[model samples]
Structures are given as structure tokens and as C-alpha cells.
Target: MELTLTDDQQELRRGARRFLAAESSPDKVDAAMKTERGYDPATWQRICEELGWPALTIPEAYEGIGLGPRELYPLMEEMGRHVACAPFFSTVCLGVNALLCAGTEAQKQAHLPAIAAGERTATVAYTEPSGRWDASAIKATATRHGDGYVLRGHKRYVLDGHSADLLVVAARAPGSTGENGVSLFVVPATTAGVTRTWLPTMDQTRKQADVVLDGVRVPADAVMGEPGAGWAPLARTLALAVTALAAEQVGGAEACLELAVEYAKVRKQFGRPIGSFQAIKHKCADMLLLVESARSAALYASLLAAEAVEALGAGGPSAGASAAFAEAASSAKAYCSEAYFHCAGESIQIHGGIGFTWEHPAHLYFKRARSSQTLLGSPAYHRERVASLMDL
Candidate 1:
């Protein structure tokens, strides 16, 4: 299938680019990074109102724009390019994906509309102090009390946890262990027993928090999907997240490459532009190749994910569809992470002393690239997944 963006998609990209350039200035980025919440609430609200970004992926039936992955993918890429500091990724991509995939009709009706309207923010709390992303790694316990569940556990590195109005938490129920006992619960952040503390991270623009759930109580209806069936939905959500992240990586890599290229063309050495030198030219060429390759991979994986959703709805796995999507997703994540890291490092190297200074934007991209590489899973982790999928 062709991967080119439609005219409308191009327009969307241009619009996002314009908005980021106009609103997300260097000063704004720096200020947001130092803030307690990692972003300005008013600015975030403006982003939602201006771009309709938070609702891009939500279906029209839920008051969203009703677009699919193909349309949403480019917008994510633009966000990455600007290193736009916001909780859109945490709430819209991850949390919304979980709800859409696993939530019952009542759950969807209750939560999705608010999210689509950008009136509320949400997140999924799964990683604990151990930092494992597996469903089986959950240690938080949710015990049945009367007709409800009481949660008692701590989660570390919960993105936007401090600011989220709602949280989808993963916990082990009663006597269940491993994947069999894990369940997802939706808890209001304002619940009496829920406490949140912000965590300092290398990428300060993106906030993370440590959450303490002390006998947090919720109704049984809060459980997403069927009890003990959390793994399948979580896995599917992760695959989609990997694809979105890959698109983000592509945007970041392209931005770094552009910055490096523009700098090289203007900066002179030996009475000649630095870009004229073979070393710099080779680096730029490599960066371009890497970005293009990453774009292809990200787009392919996203299409595969969309296709998988469609096929699953039609009753059975489409021959090799899941494996293809997994492999492409892993390949995109691993390759783009490594590629962006290299591009960022090289961009800095090309800039010499100025690159090391705090004044330059290269370091920001570098830090984001490094941090994002380890977000869902590291390059090494994804490579292992790719290999396992291939049975090699």
C-alpha cells in the first residue's frame, strides 16, 4: 500500500508546524521545564483548543474529530519535532488507547467524551519502582471489599500522574499472580487515598510522577475489560504506542538533521561552508537516510496496527498480521531510537563548542532522544522482541 500523506494530511502537518513554531518558543520550553508541573496548564489548554490534538484519535461519536492512526500519525511527528512539552501523549495516545480497546460501553461513554473535549486528562499507571513494563510484573494489589476493590501499591515513573484527573491502574487482584491475576482499574486522581509526588527526570519538559495508592477504593465497574484479560489489551496498546513513538522519533531526527544542515551551510571553516566538507556532508547524508528509513518503518507499523484492529474485529487473526505489526513496530522503535541518538550526537559534534553549551537547542533534542529511547522499551529490548518474533 502507498504511504504518502493525503493533501489533507499535509495541511494538518503544516498547521501543526505553524502552531508549534508560533507557540512553543525556546523561552516557553525552558520555563515549562522548570515548572513544578512541567507544563503550563493554560498553554496546554490553548493547544487543545487550537489544534484539537487531544481528540484527533477519538472517534467522532465521542465528540472527537473521528480520525484514525493514519491521520493522527503526522500530528505526533510534528509534536516531536518541536519537542513540544505537553501531556497529550500520555493522555490521548496511551490512556485513551487503553480505554478504547478495553473499556465497556458504559466506561467509554463516561470517560471518552471528556477526554475528546479536552476537559480532562488521564494516564495509565503500570510501571512500579522496579520499572518493568510487563503486565505480569505488577505488584500492586487490589483486594475485593464488599462490592468494590481497594488498591494498595506504589507506581513509579507514571507520566503526567500528578496532573491527571483520572488514572487507569494495573494491579494484581486477590490470589491472582503473574498475568492471570492482573487487572486494570480507573481511579480518580482526587480519590481520598491517592497521593502523587513529581519525579525529577533528565527530560524535564515531560513530567513523571510517583503515585501512592493507599487503600484507594473503586467500584467493580472500574475494571477495564474482563478480569484477568488485561494482557491482551495492554499488549495491543503497547504496540500502538510503539508506532506513535516511532513517528515522534522520525520527527525529532528530521528536526536535528535540518538544524545540522542549516548550521553547516552557514558556518564557515577555511573560508568555505562547513557543509562543503566531506565529513559534514557524509553526516548530513546519513542523517537524511536514517530519517527517511525511520519514516517508512513508522508508517508501515502504524498501518499494520490499524489493519490488526480491523482484522481482529472481523473475527480472527489475519495471517501473520500480528507478527508483522509486532516486527515492524519493534524495528521502527529500535532503529529510530538508535538513529535519533546518533543524529543528535552528531549534530552536537558538528556544532563543536556551541553544541555543548546550554544555549543551543541540540542538547534538548539529544536529551529527549535519549529519554524516549528507553520509554516503552530500549533499543536492545525491542531488538530482542524482533528476534523472538522471527524465532531466530
Candidate 2:
């Protein structure tokens, strides 16, 4: 497929860059990170109500702009470059994607409009304390009770969980086993028996929460897709998640490379710019290669993900095409995660002692790189998935 950015995509990139530069500067990010909410709600509202960023991928039928990942990727890249402290990813990418991929029409009608209107923040509750990413590893249980279901379990590393208005949860339903037992549910975060606790994060800009659902009850209609069949939709949603994250990683890597190159050009050592030196030049060259290659992989994966979303559209995909998209997602996630971390480390090295200080934005990107390496799943995890998809 063509990995080149179209005219409209380039415009999106420029608009996003301009907006984020003004609104999400390093100073602003630092201040927000120190706050209880981790991001300014007013700024988020501006992004949604004014820029319509949160509506990028939501369907128009739900009062959204009705775009896809092809349009969303460049915006994600811009957000990554600025380390934007917003719930855009967790809400738009993770939560919205899960709903669109699995939620019934009634469910989407209920939540998507609120989300698109900037009235609600959303996140998915999937990972447990065990930290396993597979559906079969889910331990949260949903038991049938009267005309509803009672949920009892804890989900860890839930992005934006503390403030999210809606929580899309994955839990094991009674009378099913293994992957088939896992079911997706739409739970209001403020519902009785639901408790949220903020987690200590390496990257304060991206807050994660521990959500406990202790005997929380919901109507049977809370189920997203068909009962005993959540794994398929969740898996597809995760593939899209990894693809979107890869795009972000590539963007961050590109930003780190830019910072290093700029610093090397002006930071003189021994009466000459460090960039003039062979060692520094080689480091920059290597970083450039890593960033460009990762960008290509991320872009291609994004295209495939968008196409997959369009083609599948809740009904699921043909086996071969699904396998192909899964492989692309795994490859992009594995390579981009490692590439971003490498570039971040190299940027620090090129900046010497100054980059190591907390004052520099370099450290923020470094921390983000480290934390994101395992946010959805580690590079090793994605690599293993790639192997499985390839039948290696």
C-alpha cells in the first residue's frame, strides 16, 4: 500500500502540530502532570468541542466526524511529539475503538454522542494484577443474577481510569471457559461497588488507574457484543491499539531525533559544534534511519488497521485478512517500541549531562518511551504474537 501522507493528511499533521505546540508546551505538560487530573479538562474540552479531535474515529451516525485511523495517525504523531497530556488515546483510540468494534447500536448510540460532545471520558479495563494480555488470562468474573449480572474483580493499568465517565470492562462470564468466557461490558465508572485508585506512574503525563469492581451489578444489556464471544472483538480492538501506539512511538522517536540534531548543531565542544564530530554525526545518522524506518512500518500498519476496521465492521474478518492485519500490527508495535526507546536513549547521550536533568523535555520523552514499551504489551510480547501469526 501507499505509505505516503496525502494532502489532507499533511494538513492534519500541520494543524495538529500548530495546535499542540501552542496548547501542550513542555511547561504546560509539567504543570498538568502535577495535578490530580493529570491534564487540564478545559484544554481537553477545547480539543473536542473546538478541534473535534475526539470525534476523529467515531462514526457519524453517533454524531461524530466519522473518520478512521488513516486520518487519526498523523494527529497521534503530533500528540506524541508534544507529549500531550490528554485522554485522547485512552478515550478515542482504546475506548471508542472497543465500542465501535463490539458495542451494539444501542450501546454506541448511548455513549458515542456523549463522548463526541466532550461530555464523557472513557477507558477500557482489561489488564489484571497478573499483567497478562490474553483474554484467557482474564480473572474478573460476571455472574448471572436475576435480569442482570454481578461483576467482581480488579483491573490494573487502566488508562484515565480515575476520571473516565465510562469503563469498558473485560470479564469472564459464567458457563463459559477459556477465551470464550471473556465478555465485554459497558459500566459507568460511578456505579455502586466500583472504586478507582490512581497508580504511581513513571510518566506522569499518562496516568493509569486501578479499577475495582466489587459485586458491581449491571443489566444484561451491558454486554457489548454477543455473549461468550468478546475475545474476537477485543483482539481486533487491541490490534488497532497497537497500530495507533506504533504511530505515536514513531512520532516521539522523530521528535527525539530532532532534539538531538538541533542540540548537536549548536552545543559546541572544543570550539566546534558536536554535530561536526564523526561520532555525533554517526549517532544522528543512525537515529534518523531508525526513525524513518519505524515511520514507514507504523504508517503501513495504520493503513492496514484502518482498512481492517472498515472491512470488518463488527461482523469480523476473513481468516486470512485478519491474520495479515494482526501480523502487521505486531511487527509495527515490536519495531516501533524498540526504535523509540533506542532513539530516546541516544538523544540523551547526544545531549550529554543536560539531557539527564529533569528540566529538559528529553527526559519526558525518555520516560514516556520506557513506560510505553510495555503499556499495551512489551516488544517481546508483540514479537511473539508476530511469530504466531506467521506460523514461525
Candidate 3:
């Protein structure tokens, strides 16, 4: 089957490219990365308020654009291209997706509109110090306490956690293990006993934090969906987010290819542009192939995710369909992760010594590549996941 963007989608991509170039230029991105919040507040405001980015996937009733996952392709790719620093990933990808997947209608009414309005920022605090994204990695406890729940856990590697206005925390019952008793809670970031600490990371363009919930208490309404049945929604959320992330990886890989080719053409060696050399030529060709392959994988997976979302609205899908969607997600995640990292590393190699310097943009992309490879799940982990889904 042939897949091509509609004219509207193409326009959206062009518009996004223009906006990112103007707002997240190389110099501006460099400056933004050094900030405590990892982005300019005004720029973020423009993204949320002016561009209505946070509302792209929100339902129409919630004052949003009501677009599906496929619509997010352009914006995510643009963010990856510029490596723009913002809470969009945490707020839109993690937070919004978490709510959309698991949230009750009441919960959606309470939170999503604020996000759509750009008045709130949120993220999913799912990973722990164990550095795992699976339900088995969730060791936090949520105990009943007078019509509410008291949560105790320390979440590490929470994207944009330190600054988000809200957090959707995943934890299990006191005696539960793995997927059993898993539940999600929406807690205000300023709630008592909730402490957030920013952790320094290799990719400063993306901010992560350590969030400790020490006996944090929230009302019963904070519970998203049915208690002890959060695993399915969370899994879907991860699948969707990772597919979007794969799209971002494609854009980053493309950027690496362009950067390498640009340098190969301008940087002279042996009295000629190094791009003229067979070795450099081969590397650029390989990078191009990786980028193209990654883009195809990302787009196909994204369309599957869009179908999954539509399925959710129509009372969910059958077991077989869910498995198929999961398989595609794992495939895209695995291939895109490796492709981006490979392209980034090749770009750095093509730039030679200058690429390793702090002043050069090549190193930034390289670091992001390394960090993203292990974010949702390592490429190896996704491969295993795919195999399991295939029952191989």
C-alpha cells in the first residue's frame, strides 16, 4: 500500500519547520539548554498558546483540535530536527497520552482542557531508579487512607518532572507485584511530601527529574479509571508515546545526515572537499538509507497508533488487533532507536575532531541519540518485546 501525506499535513509540516527554525534556531537552542527549565518560557508559551500544540490530540469537547496520533508526526519531527527544549514531550506525549488512555471522563474534563489552554503542564512519573519502563519495574505503593490514597515512591528519570504543574504517577498496591494492583494517580506537583529534584543528564535539551512521593495523599477522584486495572492503559500509553518518539528519532537522524553532508561539502581535506572521498561518500549514503528507513518505520507505526486511538474511542480492540499494534510499535521503536544513534555517531565521525567539541552541534545530537536509545526501552529490549509479541 502507498502512504503519502495529505496536502494539509504537508502544509503543517512546512509551517512547523518554519516555526522551529525561527524559534529554536541553533543559537537559541544552545542558550535554552543551559536554562534550569531547559527551554525559554516565552517560546513554550508560543508553542502552547499561540500554536495550540498541546491541544492537538485533545478531544473537541475539551477545547482542542481533536486530531489523531498521525497528526503529531510533523511537530514531533520538527522538534527532533531542532532539538528544541520544551515540556511538550512531557506534557503532550506522556501526560496527555496518560490521561487520554486511562482517565475517566471526569478526569479528562478536569485536566485536559487546562493543558489544551496552555495553563497546565504535566508528565507521567512511571520509571523508577531501576531505570525500567515495564510494569514489573513499578515498585511504588499506593495504600488506601480514608477515601484517598497515600503514595510512597521515588520516581527517577521523569521527563520535565521538576517543572510540570501536575504528575500522573504509576504505583501498585502494597503487596502487589508486576501488573497486579497497578493504578495511576493524578497529583499536583505542589502537594505536601512531594519533592522534585532536577538531575543533570547528558542531553540537556531534555530535562528529567527525581520525584519522591513520601506519603503523598490524594482524593479518590485522583484515581484514573478502575483501581487495580491500570496496566492495560499504561501499556497502550507507552506504545503510543514510543511510536511518536520513533518519529522524532527519524527527524534527528535526518538532521544528522544533512549536517554530515553539509560539512563534507564545505570542509576541505587533502586539497579537496572530504565529501569527494569514497569513505565520506559511503558514510553519507548509509546515513541517508538509515534516515529513510527510520522514517518509513515511524510513519507506519504512527498510523497503527492512530488506529489504536480510534479503537479506544470505539470500545477498544480485540486481543489480536492489540497484539498487532504492539508488534508494530516495538518494531518501530527498535529500528528507529538504532538508526538515529547510528546516524548521529556517523555525523560526528564525518566531522572528525570538531564534532567532539562542546561548541559543535554534532556532539549534541550524538548525546541525544545515546540518551534516547535507552529512554522508552533499549533497542535490545524492544527486540525482545517484539519477539514476545510474535510468540517466537
Candidate 4:
């Protein structure tokens, strides 16, 4: 199949690039990162209203724009370029994916519409203090009551947890262990026993929180899908998240490459501009190559996700499609994480003293790159997954 963006996709990318460049200038980005919410709620609402970003990937039946993964990739890339601070990535990509994959009809009707309409923010609470991403590693317990469930657990590093209106929590059933007992619940953040504390980190633009569910009670209908069938959906959601994140990393890396190139051309060296030197030229070239390669991988994975959705509708259990998507997602995540990290570090090195100072934007991108590498899984973790998939 030919790998090219359609006219509509190109338009979406152009629009996103224009909007981010205008709205998230370096000074605005700095101000937003230091805010109490780590972002400007008013600005975020304006973006959602103007761009329809939160609903880009949702189905039309749910009041969304009804675009697919292919359309979303470039939009996400542009957002990453500016290091735009918003809950769109966590709420729309991760939270919506989990609900779409595993939610009951009632649950979907209740939550998806609000999310698609940009009226509510949501997140997936899976990672705990243990810091494991696998479903089998969850230790939070959910106990069955007369007509509801009681949740008692602590989830750390929850993206947008403090501001989210809804949470999709992963927990083990009282008697079950490992993947077999894990289940997903849709808990309102305003529930009686829910508490949230923001966590400080290197990346100031992206917010994370520690969420404590102290005997949080929810109706039985809150459970997503069958009691024991949560793992498959969780894994699928994670694969999609990996693809989206890889696209973001590629965007960030591309930005770093451009910044370095522009600085090199203007900054004078011993006798001439540093960009005229062979060493700086080669570094810029390598950064370009890495960004281009990672872009291809991200797009490939996104296309696979779209194809898998289609194939499942046609023949059911498209193992080949699923495997292809999963492998590609892992490959993209691993390669893009390392590539962005390298680009960030090299961009700083090229700027020398200024890059190390707080006044420069290079350090912001560097911190984002480092933090994003550990978001879903580290480069090393994804490499191991890739190896396992290849049976090497």
C-alpha cells in the first residue's frame, strides 16, 4: 500500500501546526507549565473548541468528528512540536481507547459523549507505586458489595489524574490474582473516597498525579466488559498509546533538529557560522534522518491500527493484523524514544552554554524527551518486547 497522507490529513496537520505556533509561543509555554494546573484551562478549552482535537478519533455515533488513527497522528505530532500542555493526549487517546475497547454500551453512552464534546476530562489509572505497566502486575483490589464495588488502592503517575472528571481504574478482584482477576472500573473523580495529589517531575508541561481510592464505591455497571477479560483490551489500548506517543516523539525530535540547524546557521564560531562546519552539518543530518525514519514507523503503526479495526469488523480476531500492529508499535516507541532523547541531548550540546541555561527552550524539549521515554515504557522495555515478538 502507498504511504501518503490524504488531502484532509494534510490539512489537519497544517491547521494544528498553525494553531500551536500561534498559541503556544515559548513564553506562553513557560507560563503554562508553571501554572497550578500545569496548563491553562481556558486555553485548553479554546483549543478543543477551535480544533475539535478531543473528538478527532471518536466515532460519529458518539458526537465526535469521527476521524481515525491516520488523521490523529499528524495532529498529535504538531502538538508535540510545541510541547503543548493539554489533557488531549491522556483523555482522548488513552482514556477513550480503554473505554472504547472494554466499556459496556451503557458505560459508553454515559462517558464517551461527554468526552467527545470536550465537557469532561478522563484518564486511565493503571500504574501504581510499583510502576509496572502490565495488567498482571496490578495489585489494587476491588471488592464486590451488595450492589456495587469498593475500590481500595493507590495509583501513581496517573496522567491528568488531579483534574480528570472521570477515571478508568484497573484493579484485581478480591479473590483473583494476576491477569485473570484484573478488571477495569469507571470511577468518578468526585466520588466520596477519591483523593488526588499532583506529582512534581522533570517535565513540567505534562502533569501526573498520585490517586488514592479509599473504599471508593461505584455501581456494578461501572465494571468494563467481563470480569476476567480486561487484559486483552488493556494490551490493545497500550499498543495504540505507544503508536501515538511515538508520533509525538518524532515531532519533538524534528523540532529539536530544526532548532539546532537554525542556531548553527546563525551562531558564529571561530571564523564562520557553526552550520558551515562539517561536524555540525553531520549532526543535523543525523537528526533529520532519525526523525524521518521514526515518522515512517509511527505512521506505519497508526495505519496498522486502522487496518486492524477494519479487519476485526470483517473477519474477527485478525491475529496477523494485531501482531503487525503490536510489533510496529513497540518498534516505533523504542526507536522514537531513543531518537528524540539523542536529538534533545545533541541540540543542547550544539548550543553549548546557552542550552544549559534556564532561559533557553532547548532544556524544555530535553526534559520532555527524557520524561516521555519512560511514560508508557522505556526504550529498553520496548526493545525487550520487540525481541519477544520476534522470538529472538
Candidate 5:
């Protein structure tokens, strides 16, 4: 696979960085994070209207831009570096991916246009209070009743759930058992008996919610795919999410390295620049190595995912092909997670006491790094998945 980006891809990267630098300045991000909604509606609208970002990866048949992960990875990197407080991650990376992976023609027709137009915000509700990332760990149930299903149970750590108009939920359907029985359903957030409460998070820039579906009922058609057969699609969606997140981690790591180097060149101790000190120089070198390594891993994983999608066509990939993409995704996620946190910590160290303050963006990167490391799965969890894929 080619590691170098094409001219069009490089142009996309440059445009993204320029746009984010102007629109997502640190002060704006801080203000948005401090608010209850955690993002500016006007800014989000502009992104959709001017940049057409939300449609970047959705298929054109659904009125989307029909781009692939190659375009998405660069945009995610820019967003991460800017610590952008937007719904892109939840709405595009998780929600849109779920629809692409599992949504039938009718379902895609119903949802994708609204999403591509940025008229509706959506998120996937997967993890429960158990906090396990495995499909079999789902305890939320959708019990059949007449012509529909009644959903009961809570979903935690739902990204953008509090503001999302649509929720793609994973639940255990009646008459099915274990992971095999798990199915995906689309529920309106305003549906009766549904409660969304924002959670206190360390990374305020990216908010999460606790969603309770207390006997919320929906039509049988709410199911995304065949009943009791949602695991494969969900798994594929998660592989895309992992690769998306890895790209973000690489961006964050690069930002951390930049922050450290810029500070070290200016901050002085004992009548000399601290960057001249062997210890600080070594730290910056290590951060650069980490950032570049993570970037390559993330980029390669994204390419693999996009290629797999192309090879398998829209009907969905074969089991072996899907597993191969999943392995690459898991490897990238594992390495990038640790690398981001490491770079963030070193950036803080290089910045001294200022890094700990709330006013400084260093703390923001640090918190985001810590939270993102465990979002889809912890580094250790992905490592375990990688080992399993290797038959270790």
C-alpha cells in the first residue's frame, strides 16, 4: 500500500488545517466546552454548509459526498490538533459508519440525507454500565410486543447522546442469546420514556451522556439489519471508529510535540534555553518519534480499511477480509493511544507549571488524551485483540 498521500489528499489536509486553525482557536474551544451544549451551533452549521465535512465519507447514493477514509483521516488529524469541539466524531465517525455498515436501503434513504445535510445529529449507544466493549456484554434488551419492541436498560458513555436527534442503539433482542442475539435499532431521542443526562467528564470538549431507555417502544422496522445478526456490522463499524480515533491520536501527539518544542526554544534556565539541555532535547526527540510512528500507523490502517471496503463492495465484506481490517485497526488504536498520552505528558513536563493550569491548552490535550485512550477500548484491550488476531 502507498504511504504517501496523493495531491488531492494533501490538498484536503492543508485545507482542513487552515480551516480548523482559523475557526477552532483555543479560546473558542474553551468557551464552547464551558457551555452546556459543548459546541457552537453556528460554527457547526458553517462547517456543514461551507466544508461539507459530515458528508465526506457517506455514500453518494444517500445524498452524501461518497469520499472514503483517505479523506477522513487527514480531517480528523486537523480536528484533533485543534482540539475541535464539534459533533463530527459522534455524528460522522460512529453514527454515519453504523448506517453505512448496517443500514438497509430504506433505512439509509431515511437517515443519510438528513445527516449529510447536518439537519440532524446522531450517535451510537453501545456500552452499558458494565463498561465492557464486547458485543456479548450488552445487557440492554428489546423485547418483542405485538408489532414492535420495548427497549429497557441504560447505555453509558454515549458520545453526543444528550444532543443527538437520532440514537443507534445496540440491544439484546428477545428469543436470542449472547452476542449473536444483539441487534441495532434506531430510536428518536425524543421518544417517550427515553432519558438523556450529561455525564461529568474530564475532557469537557467531547461530552458524553447516560441514556436510559425505560420501556421505550419502536416499530419492528427500527432494526437496522436482520434481527439477531447485527454483530458483524457493528464490529465493522467499530473498526472504522478505531481507525478514525487513531488518526485523531496522531494529531494530538503531533500537537503535543509542537507545543513542547516551541516552549523549550523560548523557556530558559541558568542563562540558557532549556532546549539546549540534553534532557529536554531528548524528550522532544522522543515525542517526534512517537508522533511520526503513530501517524504512519494510523494512516496505513485507514488505507487498509478503505481498501477493504472497496474490495468487498457495499454488500459488506467477507469474514476473513473483515477480520484482517479489524486487526490493522486494533494495532493502530493500541499504539496511538499510548503514544498520544505519552506525548501529552511530555508536553506538560516541558511546559512546567503552566501546563497544569486550566487556561493552558496543554491540560486540554492531556485530558483528551487520557479520555480518548479508553473510549472505544483501552490500549491493553486493543493489544489483547491484536494478540488474539495473531493466534498468540
Candidate 6:
């Protein structure tokens, strides 16, 4: 049950597939992930400057294409298909959404142009060592200082944190907890008392880092939106991020299915193609169902996300609409996370010994599936969120 793509969307998908296929082949993906930085600078530069992807979601006023999630989701799918090693997920999905959802006009003007131009990179700092993705998980503190605020906390699992030029950090007011006192601040990566150490995560196709801000100071103007009221925007950003990531999972699952099908047709067993066997046929059929279902889930989530983002600019959605959107986002995340993981595992099983080898791309997909399943929130966690949102 795939969502029908318009002509322009189809064309964009084709172009992205061609570009990633040429620049981010399996060998390239392997080489890039082995790098300390997790991606090649030259390739990323072309992805930005030539494809104008960082500019895809930024508003036209900010020197961007002014497109939204609908357009960007397909591109994300292509990235996943190629296991492309880039910070497009961190910069475009989280950074651009953070600024758009929470930043003041002045703040947006000051930061977004560089991102749209692909001259700077940024990522959000929210999750801590606890590895929780909820607002209740935020334990960082920000205290009023001399004409600025002092932030203190440790952020872990920050996407592309080690090399990003800026960090949009979330910390609450001193002595406050939970959603009420939470605030978002934009701090330069080079700021005093800030440290970002590479994490060497399992999914090296995308890098992560440990960010420690001990007395990191930022001007009051660094706050994105009102200090105590940032949760709404942050929640919006997460929903969009989940939707975007689900699309990527769909792409990966699809690729795994394709790889399995291709291998099944070629590899011989019992003097005939393995695809001729009922077991292989069953595996391929199951994979096809999972891939298609995941694609549908991601597409549905993307549409809801587009509505939510547009609603943000139009004074936000009604409480009911917001709940519905959150429910859909969590539902998609949960289903796609498990579906992708299961599909990857099945693909590996279909390939047998070759799939288990580190040299094969099947294991890479399996690794990505497992890592991504737990990144934002595990399938169980998202299911709980969906239940809560639905008042069940």
C-alpha cells in the first residue's frame, strides 16, 4: 500500500537514486563508514552544493528550496538505500526543523542562511547518557549568568555532534525539571567548556558523539523561542525527525528485500536456483509485505508531519490534531523500526553464509536496522507513546 507519488516527487526520487548510486555505492559506503569522520568531505560537498539538499527544507526566505517533509522523505529513503554516509539526517532533519519550529525571526536569519548554503553544519543535543528520548529525560540545567546563561550537562548519542559547527542544546532552568522549565539554546561547537568526543557507534554510516557542556555560556539571544516554552517546538521537531527516519527505514527494508531477491535468483541449491524453493519464496514474500507496509507507514507519518509543521507556522494545530499527529508518528516509528529489523534479518537468513560475513552489505543493513530501531526510541517505547497519545 504505497502512497502514490506525484510526477515531481517521482522525478526527485529518480534523481536522488541516480546521484547516490553513482557517489555512494556499497564500496563507497564501506570506505566512508570506516573513516573517523564517517563520511567523505568531497562527496558530502557535492551532495550539498550540487543537489542543494541542505536547502530542501529551509524556507525560501532563508535561501532554500522551501520544500517540506513530503519532498525530503524520498531523498532520505534514497540515502538509506545506499547506506549513504552523511550528516544530512542531523543537519536537515533536526537542525533545520529546530530553527524553523523554535527559532525567532532574528535567530533564524542569523543561522539558517549558512545551513541553506551548506556552509555550516548543526545538530541538536537532547538525549543524555540515559539514552531516553522523552522530554522527561532531559536533566541538563541552564542558569542565568552575567548577561547570558550557563549550561551544564552531558549529551550522549548526538548525531554528527563531533564535527558540527553548532549545537542546538536543550537544558532546563536551574532547579526545574521535566517539560515546564526546558529551554533550547544554540551554542557554537567551539564554545568554551564544550567538548564533543566521537562515540564510534555501531551504525557508523551515521556518526554520533558525546557532548559535555560544563558551564557553557550563551547569550540570552541564543534561546530559540521563549526559554520556558520550547517543548512544543521540540516535540514538533522530534515528530518530524521520527517521520523522516521511518522513511529511511522503509528504504533500507526495501533494499534488503531487493538484495535477498537478487541473491535468491542467482544462488543455486539442489541443482536449481534457490528462488525455486518454497522456503526462499516464503522469505521473499514476507519481506515484500514488510517493505511495502513500512513504506506505507512512513508515507502516512510524513503526511501527518507535513501538516503538523505547516500548522506550527500557522499558530500551531489544535490539541486534538496535535495528538493525532503524534500518534501517527509514533505508530509509524514503531512499526517501521521492527519491520526494517525483521526484514534485514530475513534477508540475511536468505543469503545464508555470505550474508553473515562483514564483507557483505546484508550485515551492514542488519546493523543499521538494529541501531536505528533503538536510536530515537525502541519499538516498544514508541508503542507506549502511541498508546499514551491515543489515551489507551
lDDT of the candidates, in the order given: 0.86, 0.91, 0.91, 0.87, 0.91, 0.90
Off by over 4 Å in 1: 312-319
Per-residue lDDT value at 148 in model 4 = 86
| lDDT (10s digit) by residue, model 6, range 1-392 | 24767789889999999999989888988998888788899988998889899999998999999998889888989988888889899999999899999999998898899998889999999999999988889999989998989999999999999999989999998777678999999888999999999997778888899999999989999999897888888998888899999999999999999999999999998899999999899989988988888888889888878888788778889998888888888999999999999999999999999999988998789888999999789999999999898778
Task: In angstroms, give how far residue 77 of model 1 lies from its true place.
Answer: 0.8
Q: Would you estimate the TM-scores of all the predictions?
A: 0.96, 0.98, 0.98, 0.97, 0.98, 0.98
lDDT of predicted model 3: 0.91
174-246, model 5: which lDDT tens digit per residue? Answer: 6566678888998989999999999888899999999999999999999998988998789888899999999
Candidate 3 residue spans exceeding 4 A from truth: none
**lDDT of residue 251 for candidate 5:** 91
Provide the clashing-pair count of each candidate structure. 0, 0, 0, 0, 0, 0
Model 6 TM-score is: 0.98
Error of 3 at 83 (Å): 0.3
Candidate 4 lDDT by residue in tens digits, 1-392: 64668898999899889988988877888998897577888888887687678888777878888777898898889988989888988898889988878888788889888888789999999999988776656888889898989999999999989989999999888778677888899998999999999998779889899999999999988899997678778888888888999889988999999999999989998989999999999999999999999889888988987876556446544776677788999999999999999999999999989999989999889999999999998988888888887889
State candidate 4's TM-score: 0.97
Q: State the local distance difference test value for candidate 1.
A: 0.86
Model 6 global lDDT (CA atoms, 0 to 1): 0.90
Global fold similarity of model 1 (TM-score): 0.96
**Model 5: runs farther than 4 Å from truth?**
174-177, 312-314
**Model 6 / residue 336 / CA error / Å:** 0.5
